[model samples]
Target chain A: MTSRAHIAEVFMRGLYPVLIIASFWMLLRGHNAPGGGFIAGLMAVAASSAYALIFNSSKASKKMPLLPARLSVSGVLVALASGLPAVFQGLPYLSHPWWTLSLGGFKLSLSTVMLFDLGVYLAVWGAIGGICLHLIETIEENL
Target chain B: MILPVAPLLVPLGTSLLCTLTSNSVQLQRKISLLGSLLLLGTAIVLGVQVADHQSISLASGSWPLPFGIEVVVDRLGALLVFVAALMVLICTLWQMGDVDPAHSSFFYPLLHGLVAGSCAAFIAADLFNLYVWFEVALICSLGLLAQGGTLKHLDATLKYFALNLVGTLLLLTAVALLYGATGHLNFNALAMSVQYVNPAIMQAVTGLLILAFLVKAAAFPFFAWLPASYHTLPAPSLALFSALLSKIGICALIRTLSSIFHPSPEPLLSMLGIIAVLSMIVGVLGAAYHWDLRRILAFHSISQVGYMLLAMALSTRAGDAAAIFFALHHSLVKAGLFLCAAMIFKLSGHYDLRKVGGLYAEKPGLAAIFLLLALSLVGIPPFSGFWGKYLIVRECLVQGEYLWAFLALLVGALTFYSMMKIWLEAFWKPHPSAGWQAAKIVKPIPVTTGLCLLSVIILAIGLFPEPLIGFVNDAANHLRGHAP
Candidate 1:
């Protein structure tokens, strides 16, 4: 590898973490604002994938907490499970009733809809990231 | 009744769980099997409930009817869902057999995904939701078609993809146009508000939608993808594709035409009739030309779909009833015949009918099961196809469509000839390779089990078709609104 490419990789290695943190911020703030799971997930994917452009699939994949396929499927489970409470409550599925926890250390406002959004976040991150990384790796192999 | 969405959710949930458990093939397979069984259980319950009640619907997020994610299960939808779940379960069992290919590890997800999508398409109460479900099914089917990992499979996948992508695009455009013209995407809302919309816009937009569905249905001129791609799948996956995929499009057409586009669109009427007839004749003729087993069956799928489309296009109570019966009968019989073809290939070591023979002398039981399935495909007496064709022809005659009636009968004869072609070449003639007594080599227990199960279901439906007939008639009556 050239020195210029090496320098690019080092730059991306630090930038990737920042992008992921920004993605989470996007995901969390998604409920009240315009930003949501899909855009945040895309941002996260863009982060890992930029590094992958300079490196290999394995190294970039390791940056993910869960592998792409697992992340996507686990997201599905979470999303579907979020709807389960409504079934038990005899409400429509995905009713997303708010659950508030005002405790000493934590002031949390959670709902199944939030869980669903988080699931969507993880799912989008995994599926798109997987596709992008695979394509990039294919290009690298051919080169 | 409260859980109208259960039928849709079960298979999708199963598919996800299977994907999540992909680390252990055995565990994944077992989970898949359990999931399909649960799906079938849910479908059976839903079917019975819908049979009792005329219809059941649910809107997610506790939203009002028109603006929510909605699922509705009428008798027809419930029946199709039951059949889809059954096919998935059978295919799951068949895949567990020793006949599976090396790369079949992906089969679980694809099968459940396809089933889930079909179920969702059947029950989706809104146009955009239906499109989303159809895409899910389409993507999963393409995955199955391409999983063979060969150049030929890639070629087939591209063909299927290209055609389906156009259909999907057209569908999206139509939906967007309709929603923009009238601010409703729900079927009931659209149906109510469509009359107030401009006739020109309705005609053009609904025309596009019907044409899009026709492509998805593999109606004439859009059917090339089916024969090209379906031949690449293994038997289990092929059976599910043959059984459920096109039927969803037919059902969608029936739903939209009968409900939303009541009285039918002006110019599209005769055009749909001509397309149906062409599909019938062209499909059987293509089947006549193919010696490969899957290609022949693939072509026949187009023909059978034609029958259902014709009946549905009639837009009468009896016609809808006949269409529903035809869809149900054809799903069972076609899947049975495809499974039997797989067994023949297992016993004879070839899919080409020209190269294989002597099954009648060696394995009479196999020959007999094939005969029942083939005969059903041919619309013979004492089988479900017989009634399916009879109702279609009778409905055509009643509609003063003499030419369509005659052509349907002609296609039946042609279908018979194709079945005979398979029978003579694969079952009757002497084995091309002498001293190759291949009958005793392998029994294919799993395949024969599937074949027998399908045949018995066909036989039971054939013998006791009164219940199905009544149910479909009721479904048709319900679709026709309060005047039944």
Candidate 2:
């Protein structure tokens, strides 16, 4: 294994929490703002990749919660399933069905569009993470 | 309303399901076969609906037609989708016995993705949506072509990837230019706005778009990647590629020429015709020099595409009808031929005609099927290919383009020669070994059943051309902007 700089490892350890929170923030604001599924997914991937860089890939992969392919498959299924409810209601495919909720004087808006975005988030994250991990492993092996 | 989008949805959903179930090969195969059948049924229903109403257009997000993505099912699109679904079904069934276990996990997902992309491209009514679907199809195909992970497969995949990227870049540039010139991206809206755009800008856009599609379609001068790479992939993948990938390009060409650039400029028509003729001649010539069965078929695919494009170049209702008919017929026959080649490779352990022989004596049924598909491909009478070629030649004669008609016939004859060469070399010659007895054949049922199914379809179409002729004529009229 390649030796990691002590300072860099410490910095990545500190950065993970911030990155995760930032990605979720981006995901939530994505519907009305510039930040959405794609950007948020990239952010999450950046965080994970940073972890891989700081530690070795073998250790990092064991730490991962789900396989990248499975994550992507579930993401796609969720996105596709989100579209189904609208079809069942006689709306067109991917037609957003929205509802406004009152939660203790606060308005909470929910819709299938956000669910689709979330699915995209997971799908993109999984695809990029999986590819990055594979490449890193190959490079490490070559080294 | 839902019918317009069902074809795309079925495949997309199946692809996702396949990805989820990629761990189990048997399950993946079963799901894919079921999905293809559902898709075929959906396509047929959509065809009938289109016939009843002339066309069906659905805005995917329930947005207005101009702003939302539109999926339109007309006679031509429906017919192509139905044929594509059928081919996918056959290929999936063939894949059961053909695909290696190592590749099975990802193959079905990629196949479904490709099917979805092709179906979406066929019905896409917006320029950007078409581009999206093209990317989807391209990525899946690249994955498939590289599935074997051999050095040669990797090299072919790289070439395919690079050339196709260039094509996609050119298409994007053209779409951008078109949107800038007309300020519309939807097909119907663009058709209206294009008339008012500057003629020179429109001409440039048309040229670039045609060039991009030609590269994808693997026409002459841009077709080297096809022959270089297609023969290297696994048989079932090759069969699927033969059936759908280039045909998608042809479908796009037909759609663009008839709808977006109707009343085509004289120079454009002539240029397309020249390309068509060259593709036909050059493709056949290339095939004549190759002794590999798959390589020959790959070259012929280029030649067959030329016939479809030649019909489109005529820019008349008859031309449009003939182009659609030719594309559908060629997809089935070419795919059947590839599947047969796969069977030959399976039985003989070789793809080169020089090393393979005596198939006529050993496997008479397989030999007969090969003859039927090959004869059809050569445009012999009482075959599906004959009807398509007859229509295009007749249309050319009607247009007083005797040179084009003559060239078409000459290409047909050359195609006949190459097919005959394969037959003589591979089937008629005695087996090279003195003690040649048939080894125990393993699982011949799927391939045999698939070949027989294709043969019956080819024969039925040949014997009763009236239904397909009338259907394609209606589809042609629709392309001419008439509500038949």
Candidate 3:
């Protein structure tokens, strides 16, 4: 199931880089803005799905950096662990504890809530991507 | 403070852990069992705490009520959670022997996921959060249902998934409409705001909500999916599904009816009453016709749900108490019966009574336990089911709902007939085939011990029901928006 359209492959190659950067932008700005983990995760899924479509799903899956199941599991663990400090502090579960750091005169704010969001990001990306890949493979096999 | 969220945290954390260690079958089982025990412990402690405190509510992220998700553990919620946790532990023990090791990696995590979702559903104080939990439970159950990946499993899962997705959509629509109408989604907030909403609109929203919940609860008109899909799975999964899944729907119905729409419109109440009677009759008739053990039990689950809905229809404190008591009793008796049925399947290699027999002669202990559980389910005296049914009948009679009371009694007798059919065919009749002789007993000890433990609990509750009755009364009072 190799790509037969060179234009389609070229288009995907150009689109994916932009999509990945947009997804990161969405994730980083999600906390107080309109975009969030879910939308950003969808963005990432879109990029990969497009790439798979042009390059053939089997080859893309072979070259994938991480197995979707492992990614999703780790994501869930990270999300769950993000809540532990609150329990230790005698607060309600999932209560966020925030911190601010200045590195090289650049200020950054971090919190358990961000970690939770990041976890959701990874989870959604992996879950939907895995499902898409599976469906594509099944379709290919049937064809 | 910690108690309010312990039930949720234990299961969620365990599920994630299980998922992480899915490669190791032994480790997955150990973690899952340990997590279930911890969940049970937390549930018991939470129940006691709620009993003493009247009700416990916690808002996640310290967000104030009406703005953030709330988890409230009142007497009834705590009781249901505790029972669910117990069932989870027992089912996990049964799973040790029942589940194929190849499937354990998926089974353990999904089981814990289901537990977490059910616990969340029981305690959720917001309409949207309840929907979320319902979906969570549905997703996990769907995964578990499809774990075998056989043609039959896939078929059942597809049907179950499709119907449940429709129900979920309906529920979400109702939640959206309610939020639009009342501008509040939290149970407490809705209770206060609902009174001000226009009556016609409120009724419309209530109808939508009831329809969604009834579908989930497997009431008469929408119950076809239950019997079709439930009997297709393994016995341990069936046991869990029987014990907790539909009951969550019942819990949601009771909570919604009592908290948000108490003194439910008389017409709606009567409508529900008629539906309840139809469910009872249809469910029992279906059970009587089916010869398969699990199918008969599945049909009975529908009929038993009818009894609870009947109590809900009464809309009185006594009715509420009876409903709660009946729900608790039904979960225990039904789970025990399903586990027994599992053992029978193992011993006889057939769920069909026509092909299986002589259980009494082969395993008299199992036969006796099944008899006791069946009798309890039939509402025999000195069994826990009797008190629940008696209370409902009494409440109906006192409320002058004689027709409902009579129908409930009639259903009880039919339930008896169906249970007797199983007893007569499987236990009393001669063995139909040599399969019983060749059937291997797998992990008989854990399975038997779990069944016996549940049976003892049933008998203990039967013998001394005053404490539970008192608890239900308190729960009823709370549901009535009164201080206990």
Candidate 4:
């Protein structure tokens, strides 16, 4: 039988990655329907916060020492990338195409604009959560 | 084929470069300077184009108009963006070595992003597009405000966010309703169809839209969040926030008010005029009451905005022109003054007027800078501030707006009084016990030479107002449906 602490560790270890995956899914699907960058980022950060609470802050820091900022910048890049083609074509920024994807027995349509939303989600989650954790650590050190 | 998207790219690209590199503070400073220099160049070229052409719109993918998102640039938009860029550039220089290294590192990117967002907002043609750019600019300001993450900063940032959130939601609802009522999102398109819409619904949207902008600009009843939270921000952040972020609301208000709600027989014009006068009185009073230098300046920002609103409310060609000209003037002067105030705080490690003394005795250059900026603020002759007032009073008189003219003069006098208080206490007073000991200070008095130099530029603009004013007049005329 798994001990209580072991079960807890398993839960702790698995939780963030699962949350990250869920967040990515949400962001990707958010374009036409719902679940855009803002919500997904919040969810991803919530998972990160939970992980920090259960595991040692250090471990969580190690695993995700530099987030939010990193993600936010990447998200901006994703947005710019999607938007650049339009600019090169002599169009306004962020006025580009919607994307679509297909796999066996399933078809999905994707928007580059949706990718932009996902980028925002990742960026916010990473930047805000990372910064908050870092600040908390600083306060903890003083304490 | 239309508006140059390059100004937005120039900043966004620079932000990306700065954020990705882990660099020394000095390196970051250089990056900011370089980026701003490029932006200044880009702004100049774009300004020329915009001045000549009047208005230009760009749609991505060569998409046809009315079917695609468009970036539209007019003379007023170009002028404000250029002013914002220049002030940020100068403020960056003044802040060198004063702010924390980590803060400095991120400051450039955030600053540029704010510029990009502001530029985008100025030129955006669609309502939803305006909303997105507004959020982008707001986030940039919020990020700067949240620097160092002190309890005070967090609280202020939260309050700012909450007010802006509610304001934005209301704005979004108005946008949705506007689209539903007219099946149009473009400003020009909406303007054409607005006459067909029911008056009641149009008035409702106008009220909601104006409320959103008023809250952002901190006019009258919406002014509380500004003073309460703005004082807590670091000087550099505050300088930018007070100068650039506030103007976004003014621009949006001017853009929408004239285009969408013009000629409406609603009684709201008088209400706006009353709010303008009240904001001037209350803001000046708040300044008179505050001994904290930053708080004083923050209060004056509210007062300055009132004059702009007063001009807009006059609903005359000259009034509109004067308001636009003054908006540009205020952006430059206010940014310079805040930079000067930040320099003072940096030098003394105190924001209280009571504690500050003998700055002129110690730092002659800084005192001179303060004097020049204060002169500009108080509407002294041969300065940009004076020309702004001259234009407004002249326009008000021409329009038979004698009451507004009187209020303008009153506000100017009160502004002079408040500014003189800072001048006397900080620059003229005898050194009190334990007065400014420059040698014992932790950080060297952050050199405001760059910002002072920028003030000189404003003086230049004031002295030689032909080119800029010509451009502004062109914009004003364009808005009035005249030839550029």
Candidate 5:
């Protein structure tokens, strides 16, 4: 409505994507350090919270309808799938075996741990984001 | 090793898959039914494993015992998993007829979620893991209860949520305190660790845990949440809830009491006995008073659970075996009865016993199925409930606890009275509405077929109690041998 308000909204909008990117950064760094999927999920949700304040939930939801439910379902599958390779290998579920690939003297390392973290990230993102959006929508409906 | 987790995986994966495919309710229904079949297959595989090896335990993350989550399928857990699968499969079959796709997009997912939680709880080998599974079951139950979205449903869900939340919090706090005091969460390891801990702290933790389990089990004084919420559920959901939900709590109590607190501390055993007696009396009386078919069954659930707890309170080998058999018998017969009730509703358009009748003449086949299930529930001869009651009464008599023994028989008689009340009112009496005969449903073979299959299973278990009794006795021994 006012110039200052408009300026603040624009600034917050720019910070939103940065926060989204940082959530992934945190998720990636979580394996060996202080951050992980649950915290990363909070960060991602923080961006959405900002967006909900700036805009309206109907618009936000229209931009990505059914996103929350999909993320949650797919996240669960991803997580469940990550545990299967080990079970097939005659080890316990979620044993987190690792693998490495060499491409022209460059090595890429991977582990079930990261896949699991990704699943957790998506699941937490969806659950928390969906809850916030639902709450906001309910309030709007009541008003 | 794989089999230990397979049962949990099937249901969990199926639940999430159902969620992923929620857009097409018909497709979701098919997927979920397939999931139940898969779960039953997994349960069979795991059952054979448990039969051969006695117990299969897996430590998540490949960590050693006491360091990671332990998932174990002993004979009792394996058997319960088998029944849980059977109940879900049957309920899914019956619910497919009733659920409207448009409003029930989330039903399949929630149903599977509930089953997954119960399966996980059944097989969990450690305290914290059991708590997690219980929470999962609790959450899914709340979702399923609120699915109808009526004012009564919200009211019921709130009652359930409020009370169960307290129980859950107590369970968590108890687990934390146990971990803090004993430095172990694995049942086997904790059994060893508790030896060096102060008896007072151990007693406090055990009391809290038992109280939490009682609340979950719908045992006396803490059982108001059950009838308050359960009558609000649709018949299929009610059938599933009656079959699996409270039984998990009973299973948990039997496990925790036998494995960790066997040779239970002073006062707890008597306390359990008191709770059991009160639950039986109160539940049967309440069932007699309620006319709604679902509420009657719900109250009967509390009473039947009391029988299992009564067996547990006996603390003898025979007592433990009776408890396990009683649980198995109760799940099968209760689910069958609720399905029969659903069919009656379909035919007569009512759940109130006072309002509906002439079912015996309208559908003789359904009448027979209902009669068999009700007879089983009342513990008549040559039915599954007969064996459960026989074992408990025998154990009580053998133990020379005449008061409990007398009360057990008295409660059985009262149960028969209430069940016969349902029979006379719902099946025997003339239809109150003049046109009730016009609305009779002859199709929906799945409901009757499921009930018939269930009755046959109950009859088979009754006729050949030797094998199941043997299996349950083996499980009872396994529980005792868990303690260091």
Candidate 6:
């Protein structure tokens, strides 16, 4: 029993990094392809849900660390934060900011609008997951 | 930037706060109210600024146009934002004391989020961004409507969910096709690329998008889901939903067709004309026979939307302006009437016109408020509603569409009868049952007072509409591509 629990814990820990990477990749490719914030968020939430089911939810939640509730809030904050500079720039809100930084061999362009999309992905994932978690906890208590 | 974007963000930020503190009802209400006030203030400030300066657009993250979601603050979008914000704030206040603190708190955040989402939908330049906003609004609405966890409420919400999903899916399909055809989702880019696309594909895309929007707006053949779900929600929630949510669909339709597709005047205009006449007639007829006060009001919401669509269908400057004005007028009047109905429910414990009577004797102030709102609904002069209907009919007459103009006027008369039916049954007649007399009446709270004041503002606007008309004309000119 102990071994089984330990293995599940290890597997859950390993899953987060992969989920996080996959979400970013999806978001980056979204503008041109079918992969966007909504789908990427679904990916993140699906991974979290999987972890919760494999390990104890309490452990899975602690491993995830950020409460889905807080993440939900912060995701919106990040989205708004990305748009705030535009407000100061005398433009409308959520004005995407872009500056291209050239590396020795590669060009990396950072986009506030892209960041906003990531925020949306995280927020949706966290929100839906958090609500589901809360409901599950309540149902378990009642049972 | 002082654009529609900030208004969208305010509620989204507050929604997060609400979710975090979902455990505390009182905390939620305060936060919600504060959030709503912020949005309302932002909208007013932006409206003034835009009225002075003209249209504004902020590209998120400084991405160049056609690359990122562009938040627009043209005259039309800003005005709708102002009206939506006002409705949300009033509905929030009206429900404040009446709702359980916990529920009320939950209610406000979601309501704010819904408003923000709708505002975003109205101004979004990118199709994908529009989808995101639509989802946010939809999820929040589902949460608000299902808050009670009652079987009936859940059932109603589930149906709403199913219908919304289908509508959204249709929207998604249209977006996919548009992207496939042009490899661009931005409205401006798509419009430029549309002429290059095959005629058959363009027609399909237009049909799909229109169908999706019609379903969302609850137009004649597509309106069943609205009445079905609305009848089951708490009064305040239903009022907000009716007043705001459906408008998102109409907004999207207007933006897509007017800005992107830019369809010719012949087929599209005639089809919309037929749709408007059918919707107006059917909606009014539905309201006339309904004995339940809430359902009657809900049905009229559909009818009023038809009036707005009639103007939109014309696709002229006068048409768009009237659509915008009518949308604002209907949102305020409908919201006020629904909240009034909610208050009456508290006093009489029944919403059926047949059972609810003598309300005026017990709650004269409330009854009077409802009377004023209903009058606005029927387009009485010195009210905002009058301006919208008059402008549209006047334009129709000028265009030599005498038959549509006459039908439009007839719809107004029918609307008055529907309003009168409610007044006579729910307010004038003596209580038919002993239970009504025994029902306890609650006095208006400060929040309720705020709501009433908001309604008065609508009256004020009607009494002095010159400035608003000027703004509308400016907005119309911008929409007509007369201004860059």
Q: List the residue pairs that clash in candidate 1.
A: none
A1-143: candidate 4 lDDT, tens digit per residue: 11236666788787778888887787766646865888877777777776665654466666653545666677677766766655556545666555566788888766566666766775787677787667656755665
DockQ-based CAPRI category assigned to the predicted complex of candidate 1: medium
Report fnat in order of the candidates: 0.69, 0.67, 0.78, 0.44, 0.89, 0.72
Q: List the TM-score for candidate 6's chain B.
A: 0.95
Model 3: how far is B8 from its true place, Å? Answer: 2.3
What's the lDDT for residue A138 in model 1?
88
CAPRI grade, predicted model 2: medium
Please provide, for model 3 over A1-143, each residue's C-alpha lDDT reduced to its tens digit, 9 standing for 90 to 100. Answer: 73388999888878877988898898879747833888887888887777777776766555444677777777777777787788788778788877899897898888788788778878887788788887877877776
The whole-model lDDT of each prediction reads 0.87, 0.86, 0.86, 0.77, 0.85, 0.78
Q: Which ten residues in a row have the lowest lDDT in candidate 6 chain A?
A: A56-65
The digit string of per-residue lDDT tens for model 5 on B76-165 reads 989999998998888777765642111578888888889999999999989998999999999999999999898999999999999999
Q: iRMSD (Å) of candidate 1?
A: 2.0
Worst 10 residues of 6 chain B by lDDT: B96-105
For candidate 3, lDDT tens digit of each residue in B313-401?
98988888999999999999998988888788777778888988887888888889999999999999899999989999999999998
Docking class of 6: acceptable
Could you give candidate 2's per-residue lDDT for residues B1-484 as a string of tens digits?
4778887889988898888887888888889999999999999899889888889988977998799999889998899899879888887877766422226589888988998999999999999899999999999999898888889989999999999998999999999999888888898898788889878888989999999999999998899889988888887788889989998889889889988777667799899999999999999999999989999999999999899889999988899899999998999999899888877777777889988888898888888889999999999988999999999999999999999999999999999999999888888999787776654456667766777888999999999999989998888787768521
Model 2 has fnat of 0.67
Candidate with maximal DockQ = 5
lDDT of 2 by residue, A39-118 (tens): 88888888878777777666655555567777877778788777877888899888988999999989988888888888
Query: Which segments of candidate 2 are over 4 A away from where they belong?
Result: A2-18, A31-35, A62-65, B98-102, B482-484
Instruction: Give candidate 4's iRMS in Å, 1 decimal.
Output: 3.6
Against the hidden reference, what TM-scores do the models get? 0.95, 0.95, 0.93, 0.83, 0.95, 0.86
Candidate 4 residue-wise lDDT, B1-484, digit = tens: 3246666777787787678764666666777788888888877878888876877767755567676777777888788878877866766765664532225467778887888888788878788889898999989888877876889989988998888888789889989988888898888788788889999998888878888888888899788778878778766667777777778888888877776566644477778888889998999999999999889998999999999888888776667777888888888788777767766776676789998777887778878877888888788887888888888888889878799899999999999999999999987886565634743434444444566566788789778877767777677777666311
